[model samples]
Target: MSHSFDPIDNQSNNEHFQEVLDKAFSNPSRRSILRGGLGLASMFALPMLPGCGGTSTASDAAVGAITELKFTTVAKSLADRIWVPAGYTVKILHATGDTLKTGVAAYSNAGTDDAESWANRVGDQHDGTEIFYIGSNGKSKGSYSYAAGDKAVLAVNNESSAEAHFFHPTGQTSGAAVGKKFDQFGQWTLGVRPAAEAIKEILMHGVTLVEVNLDASGKPTGYNATSALNRRITPETPMTVTGPAAELANLKAMMVTKFDPTGNTTRGTLNNCGTGITPWGTLITCEENWATYFTMPAGATVPTDTKLIASRTRYGVQTTATSATAATSRTQGWHTVTDADPTSRFARWNVSASGATAAADFRNEPQTFGYNVEIDPANVNSMPAKRTSMGRFAHEAAVCSIPVVGKPLAFYMGCDSRNEYIYKFVSTKTWDAADIGGGIAAGDKYLNEGKLYAAKFNDTGQGEWLELSINNALIKAAAFGFTSQAEVLVHTRIAADAAGATKMDRPEWGAVNHANGEVYFALTNNNASNRTPGKTDAANPRAYKDNDGIGRDGNPHGHIIRFKETNSMAEATTFAWDIFLFGAEEDAPAVNTNISGLTAANSFSSPDGLWFSKSTGICWIQTDDGAFTDETNCMLVAAVPGTVGDGGAFTVSNTMTVAGAPQTANQNTFVGKVLGESRLRRFLVGPKGAEVTGITETPDGKAIFVGIQHPAEEATAYNDVSKGVWPTNANNGVGGTYGLGGRARSATIIITKDDGGRIGL
Candidate 1:
């Protein structure tokens, strides 16, 4: 992402913040969403595709019985290949356009596949991921298994067509206008997107499920593409809206379209990103950056409704009749495409008013997204449900508190933008271990009713949750209008704004500690305006130039924030907080930028994907970066974490000369003890032009599944291969003349240990 931006590109005064093809082959050729969550006002300024080496952070200290990462630390590399410790191995499980049905042919990777072929193929730009094991025998027949098993179903979120050009014969009319993002929608100038192309895009997003085989060996092999459970839940899939707001007139009225006049159901999920696994063996895939998909016809009039306008502005939803620069203002023209279908599937992308009634046009289409959609990966016949009770915004991920036998459950979430807020939903129904195999029905019983709240952190290492509901007096009489809870859920950003929630940096993925249930979130980098002067609060304090003297400003490297719930209880409204880690270049000034005493062995930037291994209590951190791509591609690192208050306070100074006048300000922030080599170390480095995200491990922690998204995004044309060559480079090294014509596909990879020992052990 970039350091500065015109207000028009982001207007972020406050708020926030792939590729493929398949043939998932090593193309001797091409490679490139820094996608959907392009908040109207806040998007990560991705650098245009496309390394380094390291030692192990010391593993001397132990947190309880949880030991440290034991593999020879992976060296930070720019080899254009996936690099792991010497004892580990990486396997390409599947890639974009890979066939899911046995009869389908392997992808040509030359962009020649017919539109219909995608229905039976893997979707592009994989994001969030989860696995559900199946019973080994009739004794556990027809039921999902939580324990280790041979047969398991995998659910992966195909976020966006980060490199849609690979889907066409020639290049599509698209360009990367912001940072280094894939920008599939940014450079498009098409007046009427072709129906065939449009349909491919429609089917490319949402989630993918397939059965896989796990072995007694340390590494799990590949998937069963022809398994009866293999399926794709794309935009055309039908789903019901559930939760507190589902029955309210506001949501129903706003959700009504010709396809579903009653507004009880909607079609498809988009921009699926982070994920959460319910204790009941189901997947909760979050919808991030779903707003930009529905744009008003270029040069249309803005909406006149005060509430509507406020909600659009707050959520960064493109509004009616707005003026945006060339290509930047338009999407691929999904609304302009014409088709024979009666439901106006092609025309539904338009959110502009054109008809007399709510059911007349696709004016309300945008309201239907921005919530977490639940899927039962093991049951292909079951319908997915959108959990509307989890107030919508640009949702990144949902990390649940460790389930207590009878205590209430809490799902922590982030808005994923500058100045946005972190939120959580407390279920009305407490945890019940009996619901372990309950699937979607279990989702209905627990997630359907909850009290939502936004987080507020004080400078003194303390924080509290502010309720967001009509029941709250502040929301009841707010100037935004006193409406039903449906309006509150739908316009959550506005509700949080009214509640005085703390503005964070771009909040991304969050993970809860298995040891003590402490919550940790990744505030993945920010620019100057978003973290403006005198706005450095304790939770997000640093603002400085990078160590390379590259002139990069703001908190470019990002940091991880952690907290302990009051009394270590999930239902606590107040908590203690501190910075668990401040990502840096390892050589920055220790007093400020490198406060955690980072070393080359464990330095990283833009901490976007984060998770804690439940089996071992070790923390896993992944990067999706634009700030540090020059020296290395994105990567995954492992660390042993300390408690929230273990860190000491440090004074950070930020100096910037305004119009030739030098000025400086300082802020004191608390942080955890430096991890050094023992507690923290690099684990895996991915291929060039790809993001390292979406990770999960098998029950015994012997194997890990990770998503390598949109590699070789540096290419400018459809057939450009010189910029990226991967998957092909995966097993060996870089191929001739750029993959020797191999295509770069966003793929799911499995990592295992050579000795059949637990991974990273």
Candidate 2:
């Protein structure tokens, strides 16, 4: 989730008559209206601008009133097809395992690719992505090569891999499980007996970068096989911590004495989900759902610190057997791979209470994987660093603003779990336009230090940004026993609870309106089981099950909440907020599953992917859902939204019982509901059992790119060829074969309007 404040001075623009005239005549529909306002003789005689033609002064004046262009549904094909307006076209720019080096073979459509090849090829499961234009000299930010008519280097995040089975020649589970015991050094002397499987797990957990060239028409022409930018960052890659953890006297000493390092550090980034691109052009990949990868051994003693436990649980690390048995344990089973050395980087995947004390064992594994991983994709030699200043949580995505010449840039993010919170970080350093091409140095200047704040939505149509600082009195008085500011920031949820922040539905991708500086967040979904008995509020009113089979209690299918900073500034603590869009079935009752007539085509469940086109000002929404998958796979929609409070108020009911008696007329009301064809439209759909995620656009607005993740994800029986033939056709056609013969692999698709006209016009 990124924070974006509008840079446009709408009020000032409205006062300028000439600028208004330019907008109105840009579209044919508005032009027709302007013509009807004048008689044929006057219409033919009016003065016209270089880009506009008109007849009368009155007709020319009519062109200045258009504020937003109506959104139209572009593509509607059942098969996987790229859709756009008449002037656009789409092409598959690259897919998982596409090689970025000369000696590496091109991606074969068949299933013959191996791990060594894949390590050098594009990584699997491409999720959040950002395009950084390399300039003519191929050295700075603004001079993107694409702008100079050369290959554009994109820093894409291969969030996770589903190629474990394919990575090992005999499969990941081919080794036999054995039991072993270790002596004094807190090491496992004996246990499982698999060597090969252990190596594969270490290689599977990081991000990959690939470089490709786009033709003059904006389609990807080919990849630069030998591009220095091509690199793979895996679990074994050494990374050092640079914040509070690195400065701690005890931690620093331990790092050198025990781990043979000068700073608090760990190896590799795991479970990277959504990402952000810095104004300086670096990739900020977020780690989500990282706790489940590790397992603490049986009959082990856990630490007594609640803060540590909360940190582990917040990220979903198994605290006990209950947490382990409750979910599908680690898929790779790294612990079972080696008996004598279970803590070998492979065995460390398990975050269980083993050995004895923290000093003797790797109990700190839970603390290693939750920060925002910053990598300079252009400089592959640089070690990826974890920016702990950005508080850790189930980070969904990070979006940033276009750094102004001298403004405090802000990053907006969402924690993607039930009842999580929304957060923002305002860089302490002011922006300098000259820093645009400053590379990682600029990132260090703007992103390294910032104040983080969590949102608290109140009933009065307003929200407060509670500071997540060590100096806060409430943080000092914590009953949870957090000792320092760093600990509070690391375990931010507990601090948020103390600050009385409002509990929200699962918050996902967020986008900033380039046109208006408003921030929008998608509250994906939350079940009734999460709501407290008497805690219903206006923003999250439904606490009982509704007709949608979800939201029975808390928010399900979720809604988008938008807020504007006071005076359209990012540094303000006070803001006005309202629900922007609600996910619902078209036929459901107005009270339960309706947001101003949102229908199936445009209505989607669990908003997971969200982005605003820098060029078109269109908001793209994508979903990762189980609640609404019965009708279709996840989808993408294009939206034009008004600021909060644009629409009038409406009342929603909240039923509850007090003293074991039913209380009637518990009505909660809120404003902000304006929906119609002009505001929202279905832009695209995904293949059967896939999620349409990670959307981005070229600077020129000529092309839009999106990721198709896990096509046919539900097909679990790998050996049953007929049940999982998706991606591949019925004729056993493999690799590179489009149209039914090849297995469906996760791919990145580029879309453009066929006419080469300005998009969203």
Candidate 3:
């Protein structure tokens, strides 16, 4: 169970946008659109100007639209199996409980796989993966290197686990018999679970590294977990902290445990979502939605310090609850320990003021999390580090642009929350080809020292990247004054707010079009309560009800927004912007619902994971949805995306209720690109109840990997497998009775052309 949704930080972007909208729109038509707040349809009324930050005539050539989609679109399906184009073949490479070492017994395909084996096995909820080519001669390029090889090392993130019941026969009884407890969501309720169960689940929440080999025919045949390169970074793995905040006095004051009195080291990484590879041969694994996993101990008083209180409040940490026996809000009941020392590892889950000072308790435990963790995939023994300079709030993905010869590298990131701001980090060090194999050392050079920036999009087709540096005048005068640079990075959302960053609609994954130096992000839906008419802005413009019957509104179908930095430079503060794609049902009217002209082959909702393939220049869009689930399972779509100003401009009439007041429908114009099935086609629909995410391909685009997450998540109990069983029956048809027999588990599958040709060609 992830943390409950919190909108505290979202208000900053809205407040800032309101100020900008007040100054930009002067005409009556513009005022009507600005009155309720600009919907996406009204923001992109002009195509992005090339070379500089100004409007230009919209055109397919201006946006750099790709030629066409190559393969036939796979039809949408609610099947209990994977669906792909006719010639594409998919094979299960690894799934939950698969061995990572030679001596481990084969997974029994039953829930009986011992809790102890989970650490040495592939984990649950696989997401954000990468494949590192290992040549037949055992030689390879740097960590960021991509190539074709008969052998490769694959890394997959196990985001989280299902209920304890899924691991046993008697459900909670099996757990309680071993002194386990569960939360309302049926996940382990207490912070302290049965030792065996706790260890298993904790170990499952990190990354799985394994080596895979292809047969003579070039098809992936088998994988070996016993390979020397195979390794797992569990929640218990020790890691060093780096960046501005690592050595802060306040941070040190917050640490008292044996793990790190200096506050420069911490254990484990959680909620690892989208990932990135660096030019220096390393993996950038993001820690997202981590704040919800912590809780305040019962009876703990909220801190008295204004800054501490404000920071905690904004990050969604419980500070006002007075309950003495239960947590105010916690993702996992990791705080409900049984018999353990108050200062023990389990005690760290409850971040309460229980001791004389910050260092005497676990009040600062969460501060160590929510960062982009860097790992050297080539060096299995290398320790991961929390790159704190990347600015921590709820990180989605860290997509870096192509490194220029002498220019500083830039990384684009999104904070995965309602109306959070998009961010960028520019390395202080310029790029050098010699550092290709530098690994963590290179990370130390480029990642440790950089400028973090937040974006502010003006309604008049322009945007600026505001520096979050303490030297900036606006941040310096913030109500929650920052005492150090580390403070600004740690409480990044607040700093971004003070810097006047634009709030987005649940910003999730981001991708950089390395070809044209353009960036795209998935603004995955917001509800009416948070995105009321008055709350919409240029970047997050839509606020209308959908036919999903979920009763949710405010860009429920979401859209993909793209922009180009001036001079095609990553460090440039100004950029041109436009709406690249709007998610909608095919048959929906051409109002706000089907603005992108999506046809039957490509209509989708709640766009989440996004990746731009360097090999083929195709932007792959994956869905994690509920609004359109009644018609189709989550899917993966391949798109030959156009650049910034492809579609020119458009408008729609929409009725919305402002911050508590009802407003009549009004017409608004927005600049956006139009894509049909020819350019954007659904390539795959996942098993029922599974979200399509984590996509990557070989250098030649011959072997592609996609993550299947949370299969059969709707099943009520351990024995209720009738709801949906995937992978095991992925080749079988829909309905309660399908293929092989087993429970559902998140796994990564390999997709290849049956003809052994390049995929998406």
Candidate RMSDs in order: 10.3, 11.0, 5.7
lDDT of 2 by residue, 645-706 (tens): 55554545545444455543324334445466555767666665567788776666656678
lDDT of 3: 0.70
Q: On residues 157-244, what C-alpha lDDT tens digit does candidate 3 reach at each position?
A: 7787554456654443332343233443323343335554555656678888788776654456658768888888877778877885
Query: Which sections of candidate 3 miss by over 4 Å?
Result: 1-9, 13-66, 134-151, 162-164, 172-192, 215-219, 245-258, 301-306, 320-329, 339-343, 656-662, 733-741
Assess candidate 3 and give its TM-score to the true structure. 0.88
lDDT of 3 at 628: 83
For all candidates in order, the CA lDDT equals 0.70, 0.57, 0.70
Residue 319 Cα positional deviation in candidate 2, in Å, after optimal superposition: 2.5
**In angstroms, how far off is 13's CA in candidate 1?**
9.6
- Put the candidates in lDDT order, highest first: 1, 3, 2
- By TM-score: ranked, best first: 3, 1, 2
Q: What is the TM-score of each candidate against the true structure?
A: 0.88, 0.80, 0.88
